[model samples]
Target: MNTDFQHGAMGPRPPDEDAIMVLLVDDQLMIGEALRRILASQPSIGFHYCSDPNTALKVAAEVRPTVILQDLVMPGVNGLDLVRQYRQSPATRDIPVIVLSTKEEAAVKSEAFAVGANDYLVKLPDRLELIARVRYHSRAYLNQLQRDEAYAALRESQRHLMAANLELQRLTKVDGLTGLSNRRYFDEYLAAEWARAAREGSPIAVMMIDVDEFKRYNDHYGHLAGDEVLKTVAEAIQAHCRQSSDLAARFGGEEFVMVLADATPGRTEELGTGLCRSIERLRVPHLASRVAGHVTISVGGALAVPEADTSPIRLVDAADKALYQSKAAGRNRATMMPEGVA
Candidate 1:
């Protein structure tokens, strides 16, 4: 067997870069030389040879030949077994295999096809027939490879698009200034939570919060300072809510709202009072206010067990009425709606 292969002598073309490349695996040097001469005339076809049957698969992997010409008889090796091994390998499984034999026999041809040989031909086949079969199988293999690459690219593009859409949806629900849920999202959440509470016979709490004399604060301190104050208050309110079932939102200018699931009236009042004290502790200056020297907040809350027949608006209206009472009563206190009011 010739150890020296003819691929380097024929001038190697990069694997998968060329349209067609042929690997001839035969123990006989004469057979390899004959096939090389036949394919040498075609400038488009690249030719490679491996005389050692043992090294045929390794050579095929390195060459990445589009089509392989395999012989049935080689010393210490069965060509059919080699074809089966080629089919089993991930690297060479998709490459077209054409079995070359000495005589045309029906049993040999049938056995060749049974073991995954694509096409079979007598040794030293007519040049035109050999070239035609190689081109036919190689064209189909290349087309399949291109399609696989295109499909993979499309899936990756879809993955990125879905991630971007999720981020966009999240942005729409958030307030740009306070990083709290916006009023629109708050309303949606309240309605959904109300329905859930009604189903479970659980109590829900709603709180209305207002910065005391905010217009005066904005006028005395520039609008930028007032904005910072609102952000600070929003953070305090969000932090005080604590539970995963609690949600805080910027309802509008100088006002915020919170929803708490499964909260009792006493618990709601306690949280509201704590929030007011937390803001006061910040010691933010409010020179123009009638409340206190430092900034203060007024809170009013309502707790109710939602019923299927009742509207969520009733709860919000009750909370709002309580908020008005807080403003009227010294402007810096927490007030809770009386039982049966909501």
Candidate 2:
């Protein structure tokens, strides 16, 4: 709703002045006919008439007139009162009203002005003045409407632009192969989480996961089949790490990494063991895997409270060293470093 409309011709031109709308509320059919004929020469002006004094307000809402002309005295209602009603209505409040009276009494003119009348003229006004007044009021209303419409369109465009940017950001951080976080995003997110843990005195954890006998699987099953296994294993890892701040990413071929924020060494061990079990449940056959008849993962994890002296790389090295031990002791298992190790 907050919009700054540039009042320039460069903004927008309302559907040509060829469709100006004017409404007349009077109980006289003969007078309506006379006024219609007078305005007919100007095809740009669309004139409508309501002969029923009681139903004039309803017809005005339907017509959405830019300018209204009301007879000062109707059969039962005073035209000044109708002008006040139009001014009070949210829909018709901005419309210009002109009072037309057969008897031009000075007091009546003053009363009409007090009741929201924009202009006062005698019945059957001068042709030049009627056209000029109608055109002026019509142009004023249409200009404002056009400006509002343009600002609305601009706001919609800006909303679409913002959504598109967010989508692009999401796509850039996603890994195309496994629909997991890409390495670039994983590295940045881990660094950020590490810094946050340091400031908050919370423990940050890392898990280095590697597929057992992956190269043998690729060699025996072909690269495409190996790709499918990689995808399945990546999904298994992602499913096990449920924390919103935890990140799972394919570190490289046959290797994946997870960064867990606000996690303890004990919690890290539990999650790493769960990841091994989840992959085992997949039951994907791997004839070349020496550790098992099916595909499996070896996980090495470390957790530490970040200090001003200790760096993120040191914690990563500890996790990497533990992963080396898991692979050496035989794959398809989880290994955790000693807790409180700097």
Candidate 3:
């Protein structure tokens, strides 16, 4: 018997992915030896023999053979049934199987094919013909495995590219200094919210917030300190806009805006006054600020039930006017858009 005919150690052989590996399951030791002699001359082909019909599937899985040569008349189990089991097992399901039988009857060959056998061979087949069939089936199976691996790699690459594109879009909408939504994103969101409010007959509130004497504060404390103050103020505003329907954004340098969907006038005023107190509580010292020793924000809010015919920009203008009133009346207070002010 050739040393290449392996019997007992059913553990997997080292992976030889490009090589043609064959697993033969036959009850007779003589038959295994005969097949071994036939394949041993071809160093490119590897062979494993499992005499126990019950463990054939296990050995096939461990060996990861590209083709299987199964004997038809095993003692305990039917060879056709074993082929069906191979088709059912995930590890060996795609492997090609060639059934060896003594009978050359067409009925027997048809049954073998019905049970998932790839080819049927008469016992002691011509060596040239056997080798040809083995090489043909092994080549086709290996090609399929390569295609599956390539497709999986392509899907993984596409997944990573989509994630990177989403991250890039989010970065564009964010303000670099304050980590709030930028003015462009704020405008887009406000328009959408306004249309929704109009359709639903809900009130929308907008607040224009300005840091007190920001230019003087920036001159007194260095620009870095000014950036820090803006970051802190942005955080305070974000804390107030906790609802999913509320949005806070950096309107421009030293200025911010908040949009509250479905808010009442009283609720809007409450949030505006609360935001002022929240910043004053931070106690970011502003020596140049005439409003307070610590940081304070002036808030001007406007509430409106949006109409389908009117543009949303008018609400923003109204809030800006109210902001001017707050600055004129000792810059620390919150003021509502006066009645009859468009």
Candidate 4:
């Protein structure tokens, strides 16, 4: 059979800047040398040869060849059988294969083509034809490699962008100094939790906290000292509500809010007391305070099973009232709203 392989069958696109790797599986060592000389002028083409047909697959895996040249007849192995095996392998399935044979009988060439041979050629092809086929198949192989690399890179970039977007969303709702959710996040979270509680028929609790005599502390210790106290108090609140669903937020200067979902009136009171004790335990000196010798906090708590007609604002208002009641009765104490305030 005359070797007249068409170039269009190679690939639609040309090769990229990367080098192309080619593996030759010819039992005859002389044929391997001839191939090397033919491809020596092409700098971008890389070549590997295997004289033992049994080791061809191993060499193909090592080189990860873009194109393979197989000799049809060998001592113990038929090149056609090797082509079938290569086509079956996940690593070599996509690689193009061309078979080299001494006989030009049409039946033999047909069998090679049937067994996954991309093209059939007579041994020692014309130098010009050899160069053309090698370059054509090599270019096709590198094109696929480049496309795969680009797709992988795009996926990685998309993953990084998604992570950055999530962080940006977190920052928008987080207080810079106290590391607690800001007022904006608190309001939104309260409303969403209230709605969810209404749907689930569960009770939600709110705690309104105030720093006892904060102005006097700031006046005596300086504003910077007051800022540190707020941060410490915020941390204490966070430590108290370690549950994933619990939210402790800075409502504003000197005021903070804690929202708890599926919580009971008793849990509310207990957490409120714990928060007060935590602040008092800080021992942040508040000598100017009338409430306690050290820094202290007043807590107001309210629990309600939300209804369709009720809004989260009602719960917040109730908690605020109780906070004032705590200050009025005495600071450094936790007080729940009067029973049946709604």
- The clash count of every prediction, one per candidate, is 0, 0, 0, 1
Candidate 1: RMSD to truth = 15.7
Instruction: Please give, for residues 1-342, the per-residue lDDT of candidate 3 as tens digits.
Output: 212355323455333345788899888888888887888777778888888888888878888887999999978699999999999998889899999998798999999999899999998888998889988999888777766865367557767989999999999999999999999999999999999999998888889999999999889998989999999999999989879999999999999999999888788888888988888888989888777888898999898888897778988998888888889999888999753353
Report model 2's TM-score to 2 decimal places.
0.57
For candidate 2, list the clashing residue pairs, or say none: none
TM for every model, in the order presented, reads 0.57, 0.57, 0.57, 0.57
Alpha-carbon RMSD, each predicted model: 15.7, 14.8, 15.4, 15.0
Worst 10 residues of 1 by lDDT: 8-17
- Following a full C-alpha superposition, what root-mean-square deviation does model 4 have from the true structure? 15.0
Worst 10 residues of 4 by lDDT: 1-10
* Candidate 1 structure quality by residue, lDDT tens digits, 1-342: 456555433433333434588889998988888998988887777788888889888888878788899999999999999999999998789889999999999999999999999999998999999989988888887767666765367557767988999989988999989989999999999999999999999999899999999999999998999999999999999997789999999999999999999998788989989989999999999999988999999999998999997788888898998899999998788899975588
Cα lDDT, all candidates: 0.88, 0.83, 0.86, 0.83
lDDT of model 3 at position 277: 84
lDDT of 4 by residue, 196-229 (tens): 9999988888999999999999999999999999
- Model 4 stretches with alpha carbons more than 4 Å out: 1-147
> Top model by lDDT, which number?
1
- Model 3, which residues run further than 4 Å from truth? 1-147, 338-342
